[model samples]
Target: MSTQYTFEAIGTHWQIDIKDAITKEQSGELYEQIIKRIALFDAHYSRFRADSLVSTIARAPGSYQLPDDAEPMLSLYHKLYRMTDGRFTPLIGQALSDAGYDAHYSLKEKKLSPPPPWDEALIYNYPTLITQLPVLLDVGAAGKGYLIDIVGELLEHAGIRNYTVDAGGDMRHRTTAHMPLRVGLENPADTTQVIGIVDLQNQSLCGSAGNRRQWGNFHHILDPRSLTSPTHIAALWAVADTTLLADALSTCLFFVPPETLLKHYAFEYLILQSDFTVIMSPHFPARLFTVK
Candidate 1:
């Protein structure tokens, strides 16, 4: 029998399932440790928290030394920043805040502001992040995936070989079980309906929908170039070896094409267009239900 636990963190619900038989006491202890780790991440990375490291850096000017643990996230961000040609940027925090997804988490519509110029505003040297201008650094897109990877490492360190860590729609699973896990894809038009399901094993999946968070004509995913929400695609999902890659790629799918993206990275993807047409990569291992 599998053991399961659920808790709230990172402004979303997280669930952990252990496929092996485990004591309730064991499960409780593991859950506590996971929650504690998540809290630490939030304290450091969450833009919503005024005391967060990201918030502090955003408030300050000049160079700031990043924590030792920030290397993985920063390195990935730097690579993505270069690969997407400024489409995927952590420097969009001001733009996001101006659109009302600020530190308070309230959704008050405001005049949209352009994101900081990537070339002039931000600079990074692994453990050090230098900001020439006052800019809010938002890593929400890839940060959650990195957090999931960290938790998965924690589970591995604990000798738990078969488990699944699910944070909202992003999931990472590793199991000795013969059957692959089935994950549902939500329809952008109707949240209640599952458009399709993906069979996953020992992999990570991240899903992003433009309609997930919206106010007026603006949504969470913004095009840095146009200073507006992308209208071409409604939703996208990517499966990768790690949650971090999957999470970042899900957002990247909006701005970059699969052919262009595959040149630098390897992942399977499925995208739902604004016209309700579903497109999938050749190797996308999922059964997509057509919209009739």
Candidate 2:
């Protein structure tokens, strides 16, 4: 039987089908519109870019008001700041720049060495308002997911329920009774290949491996506590209800040990040890586990 295909948006690979309720021409047009919508939302919501409104707030020091869209994210960011006891912080911009990674990515392809991890240099927090200076917000991990959430909302409002939004390596899946979605886990030692697989149904997944996009022996996953590259685990796979949580969890949980993860999160986990041993949460769906 021929399989059904769902339209995709926001630079994510489209898992579309020639067979759908809408005609081929209509689907193509809708996809194009979605892409344009993605760009519009990105320019407005980005906090890292100097052109964004949040960046304007970051540049200005005292008592700055924000748009409604930015208020929720900025508010939640502060909450995360308190939750991890400063472990998962967005105020490491200066530290990241001083240590290297000043650019969007390493302009010099194949860098000789990875720069050091960033520290939250300074913060100003009150009941409602919070501010930070000298720290650049590299929300690369979560910002895209945030975009996914926004775009997903727009798509849903447009009466398109069966679709997916993937930004970079992060993806959010929302589909009808199509075949189950499958995502592969990359080995931190050699990320070119899939080390494992996970089943997906109306879910979101993000991978943070110390192997791919490396800086010599150093990888992108940095430890906030140690102020250096992560050493404990090879890669991490996190699944959650929201892409925001999935993205942040993938980024923050990578720094701490598995024991710390077990202590805090009640959701499923798939962690790869430095020695290649796998640690999975008790609730992980058995059908998804790949035998390697």
Candidate 3:
């Protein structure tokens, strides 16, 4: 028996499953803790929130201390920023806001300029971030995945062994029984149907696309350099040992070729083109349905 908890937080929905049954009292305690932890994360990172640490950074250029848990996420961002030739950047926050995906959900586009270079915009040294200029930092690409991993760690710390932490479809699953979780890959063009299915066990899977959070001529994923969204790919997904890598790669694949990232990471991927053609790693571990 499993107990699943569902709630909305950090601009998305979260569903966590405890594969092993627990007493009602235990479940209640765990749920409370989860809610509190997610709230803390939002308070620190949510760009949409005026009270968030991200907002504080946007207000002025100064050296600010980060939470103890910020090292992993910031480290990954730094690596990805370098690996993707500045395409995948936290500095894209201002451009995204200009495109109208702001706190107001205005969905109105304004003039946009390329974000500043990563090195010039800020300096990230674990537990401390120094902003050289007033800039908006958006970590939407991998923040959710990192948070999922955080929640997963929380469960493990509490002695829960079999569980899954899913936030807005990006998830991390672990099971002592070695049972695989079958997940469907949703079709961006046709959300009512799935393009394929993947059997995930002891791994994390993340997908990204322009279908959601879209505006007149832009989606959430915008190129920091070109200041435009890629029209070639419709959707993409990645599976890796950690949700952070999977989430970051799903976004990175939009800008760089697989071979470019393959040199740095170990993972499987599937990319669906706008014209309906598919590109996937040979060992992607997913069965796709025919697209007509």
Candidate 4:
């Protein structure tokens, strides 16, 4: 028999579904472990929490040493920062807060502040992060995906192979089953409608929409260069071998076109433009719905 558990963390709902012959007690134990693991990630990485490591670093000046757990994400951000030509940056945390997404999670629209120059904003020496200017570091772009992967690793360590870790729109699955999982792509204009479906197995899929979290004229996804929400793409979805890559790529695809991103990354994507037209990568493995 299969079992499913749901919990809230990092400002989003997390669902873990295990397709296995597990008992109620075993499932309960697994759920508790998952919750603890997610909580650890929140404590270290969540910018919404004032006591979080990321928040402490953002509020302080000069150099700070990150914990061992943050090394992977920091390295990933550095690589993405260069690859996307500053399109994806952790230094946009202050810009996001100025845009009204602050430590309290308030949604009210606020004044837009231009982000510091990418070249002179900060310095990263692996485990040590040094800031030359006043900058807030936000890793919300890929942090959730990284946490999802961590949860998946926990499951694997516990001998759970056929399971799915879904954090809101970010998802990761590993299964030996014969049936392919069906993932619905929601239309940004209408939440109830599915614009496309992806048949996935042993893969990760992450979707981001500019309309999901909006306040006044502001959306969650902001361009560091303009300090404003992007108007070109309404939503995007990416499938990759790792949830971290998929999550980062989904946001990166918003600023950088799929054609340009494809040269550097190996992933399939689907994008819905602000004009309501849908476009998919040449190798997008999803079947689009004709009527949407």
Give residue 51's lDDT in candidate 1 (0 to 100): 91
Runs of candidate 1 exceeding 4 Å displacement: none
Write the residue-wise lDDT of candidate 1 on 1-292 in tens digits: 8888788888888888888787788878888898898889998888898898888988877888887678888788778888888889898888888878887767776777777667788778867778898888889889999999999998888889898899998999998766688999998899999888899899999999987778867888888888888999989999999999999999888998887789988899999999988889887878878746
Compose the digit string of candidate 4's lDDT tens values, residues 187-251: 88889888888988899999999877787667878888877788899889999999999998988
Lowest lDDT sum, 10 consecutive residues, model 3, at 119-128
Backbone clashes in model 3, listed as residue pairs: none
* RMSD values, in order shown: 1.5, 5.0, 1.1, 1.7
Clashing pairs in 4: none
Worst 10 residues of 4 by lDDT: 109-118
The sequence of per-residue lDDT tens digits that candidate 2 reaches over residues 79-113 is 55555566666665444444445546542333222
Q: Which candidate number maximizes TM-score?
A: 3
Q: Estimate the overall C-alpha local distance difference test score of candidate 1.
A: 0.86
lDDT of 2: 0.58
Off by over 4 Å in 4: none
Model 4 earns a TM-score of 0.94
lDDT of 2 at 66: 45
Error of 3 at 126 (Å): 1.9
Kindly give the stretch of ten consecutive residues in candidate 2 with the minimal lDDT sum.
Answer: 111-120
Q: lDDT (CA) for every model shown?
A: 0.86, 0.58, 0.92, 0.84
Error of 2 at 258 (Å): 6.0
